[model samples]
Target chain A: MQIKSLNDCNVVQMEEKLDALTSDEVEKALMGLIDNGAKRIVCVFELTEYISSAGLRVLLVVAKKLKKMGGELVLCSLKPLVYKVLDMAGFISIFKIFGSEEEALKSPQEK
Target chain B: MVQGVKISLFGNLILFLVKATALPFVNSLAILSDLGISCVALAISIILYYSIKLADKPADPFHNYGYSKVENVCEAMEGVVLIGIILAISVQAAMNFIHPKHTNMPWVGFICSIISVVINFIGAFYILGLAKKSSSPAIHAEGLHYRLEGFISLAIGISFIISIILRLNGLNKIDAFVDPVATLLVSFMLIFPSFNLARSAFFKLLDASIEESSKMEVIKLLGKYSHKYCDFRDLKSRSAGRKKFVELKLILPEDIPFKEGHALAIALEKDISRNISESEIMIKVEPCGKDCHYIQKNQRCPYL
Candidate 1:
C-alpha cells in the first residue's frame, strides 16, 4: 500500500493482492487519509492482481465517506478481475472510474 | 533478437564447458546430469539463434500472420529438450542407485558448478530483460530455461559440498547416494518450467484468447459510450504473439445516422487504441432491437 498526494487529490496504489487479509489495512489507510482532511481520493488498482469482496467493501465505505463530505472517490486502472468483481457487485454504477490516473485526476469533483 | 540469442548461446557454451570439465574428475551423477542439460542447452541455443531470425521475418505471401509461431515452435522444442534431459537424468540416477560410485574431486566440481550457476544467473537476467523489452517468447522461454538450470547447478554444488563433508566424517555409503539423489531432485524441479513453456507455446499455437483483463479493458472502454449507443454487444478478442485482434459489435439507435455511427466507432477505436496499442479492432454498428433484421437469423444478437 502506497499513497502519493498530487495537487488536491490523494492517489492510493494498492499492492499485489487485496483479499480479506489485506482489506483491513486498506480500510485503515484510506480512513487515515480521509481523517486528515483529504477530499479527493483516487485508488489506483494497476498493481493489484486480485481483490475480493472485503476489499470492495473498503472502497464502498471510502466512497460513502467522501460522498458525505461532498467530495469524490474515484478508481483508476482496475485489472480485469477486479473490474469484473466490481461490475458483478453493481459498484460500477455507484462509483466513478477511470482508465488511468491522469483521467481520474482530471475528472470533475462531486458537489 | 539475434544479439539476444548470440549472448545466450555464448553463455550456455561457457557453462557447458565448465560443467563438462568437472564431470570427468568428480564422477558425480549430478554433475553428469548438469553437463547433459547444458549440452542440450547449447544445442537449443543454436536452434534458437535461427528460430529468432526466422520469427523476425515480416508477413509474406505464404505466411499471412508472419513468423511469430516460429518463436512458439522454438519454445516447445526447448520444452521437449528439457523433458529429454529429465529422462536421461532419471535413467542415470536409477543406474547410480543400483550401483553407486563415490564422487572424486568433490571440491573442484563444487567450484565449477558455482561458477556455472553464477554465469547462468547473469545470462538469464540479461536475456529475460531483453525478452520483456522486445516481447519475444523465444528469448523469454530461453531465459526461463537458464534460470531453472542455474538453480539446479546451485543445488548440485551444495549437494557436492554436503557429500564431501559427510565423506570426511566417514559416512561413505551416504556420500555415495548423494550424487543420484541430487540429480533426481534437480531433474524433478526442471519439469515445472518445461511444462509451463510447453503449455504456453501450445496455447499460443492454438490461437488462444487474450487475457481476461485485457478483454475487460475493452468492455470498460465501451462503457463510457453507453448512453450514445443503444447497447454494446458481442465483443470478441484473441491474441497471437504480441498482437491482439478485437471484434466489437455495437447496437445503435435506429434514429442515429450512418455517418454518426461510423464516427462513433472510429472514436471508440481511438480510445481503445490509447489503452491497448497493439490491438487491431473491428467495430460493427447495427440498429437497436427489432430494427436489426439480422436478429431473426438466430445469429449472435443481444436484443433477441
Candidate 2:
C-alpha cells in the first residue's frame, strides 16, 4: 500500500488480493491517512484483483468513519472483477467511483 | 472427551464392585446408598461412553442431522437413573428408621468408602477437564455424575466412621440412626442436579436456540455489514446436543450479482460459525424487490 497527496485529497494505492490476511493492513493504512489529517480520500484499486468480506468490511468501516468526521472517500480505476464485487454487494451506490485518477481529482461534486 | 469417558466407565465399575461386595455383609443404609450410587454411575457411564462414539457419526441418508442428539438423550437418561437411585435410597432409608441397628464392622465399610471417594473425585475432575477441551456434553455429564458420586461416598464414609466411634463408646441408639440419616441427607443433595440435567436435556430435545452470548456474537457480526445490504429477514438459531445451527435470509440491492451476494453470505456464515464452535450455518440471499425506496424513486441505479 502507498499513500500520496494529490490536490486537496490523499490517494491510497491498494494492493492485490484484499482478503482476510491483508484487510487489516489495508484498513490501518487508510485509517492512518485520516489520523494524519488527510480528508477527501480516494482509493485507487488498479492493482487489486480480489476481495473478501473482510476487505469490504474494512472499506465500509473507513467510509463511515470519514463520513462522520465531515470527510469523504472515493474510488477510482477499479479492476472489472473488483467493480463487479462492489456492485454485487450493493456498495457501489454508497461510494463515488471514477474512471481515472484525474477525473476523480477534478470532480468536486462527486461526493 | 473419549479418554474422559473411558476413565469414568472404568472408575465407576471399580467403585461399584467394591461397594457391591461389601453391601451384604455391612447391613447399613450408608453402605447400601454407596452401592446404589455406584450401580447407577456404572450404568450411566457405559451409556455415555457409547453415546459419545455414536454422536460423532456424520450425517447420512438415514439421519439428515447426524447423531449429535444421541448425547443429549443419553444425558437425560442419566438424570433419570440418578433420580431412580435417589428414590431407592429414600425408600431404604425410611425402612432403616423402623429397624435401625448398628452396622457390622463399620470400619471396613469406612475404609472402602474412603478409597472409592478418592478415586471417584480424581477421575471426575480429570474427565471434566477433558470435556472442556473436547466440548462433549456426554463426557461433561459423566464427570458431573462422578463428582456427585464422590460427595455421596464421602458422606457414606463419614457416617460409617461415626457409627464405628459410637459403637465403641456404647452409644448404640444414636449409631443406629446415623446411617439412615446420612442416606437421607445425601439423597436430598442430589435431587437438584438430577432434575437440572433432565430439564436441560428436555430443552435440547426440542432444538432450543444457542446460548445468548453466542446469539449476540452473530448479531454483532451482522451489524458490521448491516449497512451494505438492504435488509435481513427470518433470522433463526437452534442447537442439538453439541451441534449449533444458525440460519437467516439476506436482502441486497437488485443489481448485486448473484455470486457476489453469495460471497457476502458465505463470509458472514463462516464468521458466525467461528464464534460458536460445532455450528452449522445457512444464509440465503434475495435481491430487493421493487418496493424499496430506490425503485420507488425511479432513479437508475448508478452502479448498474
Candidate 3:
C-alpha cells in the first residue's frame, strides 16, 4: 500500500491481493498514517484483485478508529469480487462506498 | 473490441515465447504449466476478439435482441478452458510428484518468470481498466486470468529460488520436489476464480436479476411517489449484459383519466431512468376499485 495526499483527503492506494498474509502490513501502515494526523482517508481499491476477511477486518478497524477521531474512512473503486464479499458481509451499509475517487472526494463524511 | 483483442493477442504471444524458451532450459514442471496456461490464454483471446466483433453487430430482423449474449458465451468458454488446463496441470504435477526430476538452470527460469510477471501485471492493469469502461465480460475475464497468471509466475519464481537455495545447502532431493509442488499449488489456485467466472456467466445466461443495490435503488425511487398511485405491483427486473429490464404494474383509482395515468407512468419511468440510466422500464397502469373485476371477484387483486 502507498499513501498520498489528494486535496484534503489522504488516499491509500492498495496492491493487487489483500489476504491474511498481507493484511497485517496494511493495517500497520494505515495506523501509522492515522497517527501522523491524517484524518480523512479514502482507500482506493482500483488495483485490488482479491480481499479476504482479514482485509475486511483491517478496514473495519480503520473505520472505527477514524470515526472515534471525528474523521471518516471512505472506500472507492472496488473490484466486483471484492464488492460482492463486502456486500455479503453486510459491510456495504456500514461503510460509504463510491464508484470512483472523484465521487468519494466530493461526498461528505458519513455521520 | 478489435483493438483489445489485438493487444491481448500480442501480449500473450510475447509471454508465451519467453516462458516456452525458459521451459526447455529449466526442466521445471511449474514453468511448463505456466506455459500451458499462456497457450490457453492466447486461444481464448483470439476467440474473444471474434466474439466481441460478432456481439457488436446491431439488431436485425432475425435477431432483434442483438448479439450481446455472445460475450457471455465467450466468457463461459474461457472458464471451461481454464478448468481443462487446471486438470491437465494437476495430473502432470501428480505424476511428477511420484517420480521427481531435478530442474536445471533455475536462475534462467526465475528470471523468465519475473519478466512474465511484470508483463502480465501491466497487461492486466490496462485490460481491467478497459473492461470497466466498456463493461465487456470477455475482457474482464481475460484481465482476471492475466492477473492470476502474474501471481502464478511470481510463485513459480519463488519456488525456483527456494529450490536453488536448497540445492546449495546439499538438499538435492527436496529441491527436486519443489517444481511439482509449486505446479500443484498454482493449479489449485486457478480453481476458485475460474469457477466464479463460469458461475457468474451462467447466471447472466439464465437472465438473473441485477445486483441487490441496483434493485433497491429502483424500489426506493418508486417508493418516493407511492402516494401518487393507489398501489404498485408485480415489480420485476432482470439484467442482460449491460442493460437492465424492469417491468412494473401500477394501480390507479377508476376516476383517474387515461391521460393523467399515462402522464404518471411517463413521469415514473423518467424518475427510474434518472436513477438507473441503463434500464429499460415498462410501467402498466391498471384501473382499481370498481373498474378492476379481479378485485371485485376475490375482494382483492392478486398483485395488490
Candidate 4:
C-alpha cells in the first residue's frame, strides 16, 4: 500500500494486492482515510494481479460515499486482466481512472 | 436458440409423459407440478431457439446493431412464462389444500417421483455442460430452466415420501402444501436468471461499455499518443459490441507535408493496435502553428 497527499484535501493511494476486499477492510482503510481529511482520493494499483467483484463492490460503496461528500475517487495503474473485469462490469464510467498516479492526482482538483 | 429448445423440448416431453401418467395414479401435487414445469420448459425452449438464431444474425443495412438483444428478450419472456407457471401451480396447490382428496396410488407416485428426479437431474446437467462449453446465452438460460425443473422434480419426490410418512402420522394436509411451495421456489430460481439475462441484454443493446477501468485506460493511452503526435485538439470515443471506437485530433507542424502527417497517423494507429488488440482507433491529423501548446504540456514528442 502506497499513500500520498496532494494539494488541499486530495490524496492518492496505491495497492498492489489483488485479494478480494472485505467490507470491514474497505471501511477501515478507505473510510479511515476519508475521515482523516482526504476529500478526494485516487487509488492506484501497480503489480496488482486481479480485482474480483467483491473488490469492485467495495470500490462502488467508497465511490458513492465520496460522491455524496462532493469529493471524487479515482483509480489508476490497473493491470490488463483487472481492466477487463472492470470493463465487463461497465464500471469504467463510474470512476475516474488514469494511467499514472501523477496524472490522476493532477486531474482538475477542487479547493 | 432453436437447437437449445429442441433439445429441451425433447427431454421435457419425455419427462412430461412420466410425470403426467403418475399424476393421475398417485394424485400427487408434486408430480403434477413437475409435469407442469416440464411442459413450460419445453415451450420456452422452442421460443428461445428461433429468437437466438435471429439475434445472432449479422448486422444488415436496416439494423446496424445486429439482433443480439433477441436472446435477452427471449430470456425475459421465458422468465415471465416461468413466473406464470409457478403462480398457477401455487394457486392450484393452495386450492388442493382446501379440498383434500384420497390418493390411493401412492406407490406409483413414489416411483414416478424417483424417475422424475433422476431424469430431470441428468437432463439439467447435460444441458448445463453444453452451455458452459459454449458461451450461448440462450443455452445458458435454457440450462438454468432445466436445473430449476430438476429441483422441482426432486422437491416433488421428497414431498410424496413425506406425504406417505405424514399420512401414516395423520397429517395429510402436508402434501397439499408442497406443490405450491415447490412451484414458488422454482419460480424464484428460474426468474432470477431470466431477469439477470434480460438486464445484461438490455444494457448490451444500449451499447454499454466493456468496463469502467478499460474506458479510462483507453482515454489515458489515447491522450499520451495525442501529446506525442502534436498539440492535442480533440478526443472522442465510444464503444459498440466488443469493439472500441476512438477518434483523436492532433495538429502536426505545418512544415511536415500531408504525406508525413498521414504516415505518422498510420504509425500511431499501429502502435495503439499493438498495445490494445481490441481497439479500432481512428486518429485525425491537423496542421498546427509552430508554437504548439503540447510542447509545454509534455516535454517532447518521441514519435515526431
List where candidate 4 sits over 4 angstroms from the true fold.
A1-111, B1-5, B102-104, B169-294, B297-299
Instruction: Kindly list the per-residue Cα lDDT of model 2 for residues B110-142, writing each as its tens digit.
Output: 888888889989998899898878767778888
Worst 10 residues of 2 chain A by lDDT: A61-70
lDDT of 2 at B290: 45
* RMSD of model 1 against the true structure: 11.8
Strongest candidate by lDDT: 3
User: What would the DockQ be for model 1?
Assistant: 0.03
On residues B56-137, what C-alpha lDDT tens digit does candidate 1 reach at each position? Answer: 6888999886776777788778888888888888998999999998989999988988898899899999999998887677
Kindly give the stretch of ten consecutive residues in candidate 2 chain B with the minimal lDDT sum.
B295-304
User: Model 4, residue A6: displacement in angstroms?
Assistant: 5.2
Measured over all alpha carbons after superposition, the RMSD of each candidate to the real structure, in angstroms, is 11.8, 13.4, 15.8, 9.7
Query: What TM-score does each of the candidates earn?
Result: 0.69, 0.71, 0.67, 0.59
lDDT of each: 0.80, 0.80, 0.81, 0.63
Model 1, C-alpha of B221: deviation from truth (Å): 1.4
DockQ of each: 0.03, 0.02, 0.02, 0.07
Off by over 4 Å in 3: A1-111, B290-304
Alpha-carbon shift of residue B223 in model 2 (angstroms): 1.9
Q: Per-residue lDDT for A47-91 in model 4, tens only?
A: 667665446656665664454344668888888888887776667
Which has the higher lDDT value, candidate number 1 or candidate number 3?
3
